[model samples]
Target: MAKKCLGVREDTGDPCKRPAGSRSDFCFAHRPQEGNEKILNLQHDPYHCPDDGQKLWYVPRLKLHRCGMCDGVLLNEKEIDPLVLESVLGLSKVAEEGLAVECPTCSTDSDLSDGKFALSNFAMEWGFAVQKSKYHSVYYCGVSNVGHCKVCGSTWFAGPGERDALGKNVGKERGFWRVQPGGSKIWGPLDMQQRLREERLRLVARKTEKRERMREKLCQHVDSNGERCNRRKTQKEGSEYCFKHRPK
Candidate 1:
C-alpha cells in the first residue's frame, strides 16, 4: 500500500530553501496551510514578487491577466477571448422572459431546446388525448368498409386521426393496428373496422357545426355587461349564454 504523504509541493528544479516534506517534495518549512485554512502570511517568489517573492514556488502568468497564485503564490497572464470567458464564467446572458421554459414534470430546464421535448413531456403527463388534439393524428387502418388508406406519396396506409381512439381502433374489426412514426397509426384490412373511425369523425364534425351555428345566432343577444345574460335578463351571470361568448 502506498502511504499517503502530508502536503507536499511537486518537485520542480528550484533548490529547496525552506525545506518542508509532507505528502509532496517540499520540506517541513514549506508546506501549504492545512485544508481550507487561510495562510495569513504567504511566502512570495522574487521572480514574480511582491507576489511570489517570499520563497513559495508559483508561476505567474505575464501574458494572461490571471494569477492562479494561492496563499500568495504568483499568477500568469494568458490571452483569452472575452466572449468565451464571459460565456464559460456565467457572465453573459439574455433577458429572463426571452428564455424557453423547461418541463416542470421532468424537472429540466433547457435554454437550447425550442420546447418540443417540453410539450412532449406535458402530453406524457396529462394524457395522449392532449397530444392528439394539439396536433393532427393520422389514422390509417385498412378496413375496406371505411375505404382504403388515402395518404398519397407513400406506400403504406398511414394513420392520422383527430383523436387517439379513432387512430388506434379505426380498422380494429379487421385486425389490430400498430402506430408508426410517420404521423400515422395504421389499421388492418378488416371489413368494417376502418369505417368505424371515419363515422366517428363525421359525427363529431356535424355536431360541432351545429353547435357553432347555434352559438353564432345566440351571441347576438350580448348585453353591455359583456355577457348575454339571456334574451331578456340584463344581470350578468343570469343568462345561459353571453352575447359575445356563447356556450356551445
Candidate 2:
C-alpha cells in the first residue's frame, strides 16, 4: 500500500490523506511549523510542473486552478469566461430541475432532461363492454423506462387504470407494481431475449432426456417362444416388470 499522511486536516476536521513527504514523516503542510512555507514555481512545459512533472489541475478559462503535486501555478495567462465556466460547472437551473424526480421505491433521484434512458408514459385505450365509457391504462416497464433503481433494485410500473400525473393508479386494477428487490439487470433487450430463448431450449432438452431415460427402462417381457415386448406397460415407477407379469 502507498504511504499516506499521518497528519490531520485542520480545516475539515478529518485526517489528512495526502501522501507524506519523501524526506519527512509528515506531509508538506504538516511538517514542523518552522520553515513550512510552500514552494510555488513555473513549469518547464505548459500544464505541467517542471520540478515534479505533475499535471496541473486547473481551468484556464474559468480561473479555477489547482496544482496536482507542487501546489504551484503552471499557467495563469488565460482570461476568465463566466459563461463558459457556468456551462462547464452545469450551474443552470434547467440542469438542477432535471434531476428533481426521485424514484418512489428507492428515493433515488434521476435526471429527466439530457437523460440517455428515461421512463415514458404509455396508454392503451379500450371501450366499456356495455357502455361507451372510454377506459385506458398506463404502463411503465424496465425495458421501456430507465426507471429501474440501482439502490433498491426496484422496477416502477403503473398498470392500466386511472392515474394522476405522478403515476399513481386510482381506478380498477389501478395500481403499480413493486418488483421484489434483486440483482440488477444490465443486459440489453436483445441479450435478455436471447437468454430467455436459451433457457427455454435447455428446459426442453432436459424434458426430452428424461423421457428417453424412461423409455430405456421399460418392460422387457417376451411372449411364449416369441420376440421381446416393446411396451412400457409398467404401472409402478422404476419397476422393470409389466403389470401383468409383476407378483400380486
Candidate 3:
C-alpha cells in the first residue's frame, strides 16, 4: 500500500542515505527536490516558510516568496502581476510590470524565491489557513485589500456562495484565510488578477470588433462619390445609399 519503503539498501539492508538527501533513511526530511514534492521536514528544509507557522503540515495555496526563519508564505504565480506584491512589500506602487524585489521582512530574492520560504521545518508546527489567491502578485492583493499581512483580515463567508449556517447567502465572494507573517490569522484569497485580466481583454476585443463593423457600414454608405454621400438621412437610411450611391 505504501509502496516499498524505497529506502532499502541492498548492500547493508539498512535504509541507505543518498548524497543529496538527508531523508533517504525514511524521508522524514528532504531538500527542495528540484522537481518534486517540497517535503517541509528537515532541520534546514529550504521550502520552510517563516510567515505564519504552516510548514511540515501546511503550505500556502499560492506563494511568491517566503521567510527562512518562521516559514511565512508568499504568492508568486505567473498568473499574478509583479508590481502588486512589490506594492505590498513596499517595493513599488506602479503595478504596470512586476520587478525583482526583496521582502521588507527578509533578504531573499523576490523572483524564483518570491513565493516560497525555508525556515520552519525544524521543531515547531502550527495549524493555520491560507487564502491562496493573488492580485498583481502571488503574495498579496492589488484591488481589494490595503496591504498583504493577514493579521487584520481574518473572517469568513462559510461557503463558495458566502452562506453561513443560518441559510442566508451574501452572494459575495469573501477572501481566503491564513496567519500573518508575525501576527494573528487573517482572511484573504484577496484577488484573482489573471482572471480579471482575461475578462478585460475579452471585453475590449468584442467592443473593438463592434466598432470596426460600424466604421465599415458608415464608409460603404459613401460609395465612390464623396459629395453628399450615397445614403440619405431618411428613416430607411439602413437601406438607402450615400450621395454617391444615390440614383446618379
Show how many residue pairs clash in every candidate, following the order shown. Answer: 47, 2, 42
Please identify which of the two predictions, 1 or 3, would achieve the higher lDDT against the true structure.
3
User: What is candidate 2's lDDT per residue for 1-248, written digit by digit as tens?
Assistant: 45675554332213457887887646888674223221111122223332244443433222323333333221121322333222212311222334333333222133342333322222211111112256753332211112232343322222223432223333432212111111123212333434543554555566678878977766677779886666676767667777776657
RMSD of 1: 25.5
lDDT of 3 by residue, 16-127 (tens): 2544334332433322233233222222343223323332222323322333232234442341334433323442123422322222223222345453322111111111
Q: Give Cα distance to truth, residue 242, candidate 1, Å.
A: 5.7
- What ranking of all candidate models by TM-score puts the best one first? 3, 1, 2
In model 1, what lDDT does residue 122 have?
8
lDDT of each: 0.28, 0.35, 0.30
Which parts of model 1 are misplaced by more than 4 Å? 1-154, 157-186, 213-217, 221-248
- Best candidate (score: lDDT): 2
Q: For model 2, how many clashes?
A: 2
Q: Write the per-residue lDDT of candidate 1 for residues 1-248, one digit (tens) a residue.
A: 33232232333213334534536443454444333111211221122212222333321111111112222111111222333222222311223333323222122223354444321100000011212475665433221111111111101111222223223443222212111111122321222223444555565576678867766545355467876433432235645444445543
Q: Following a full C-alpha superposition, what root-mean-square deviation does model 3 have from the true structure?
A: 19.4
TM-score of each: 0.19, 0.19, 0.21
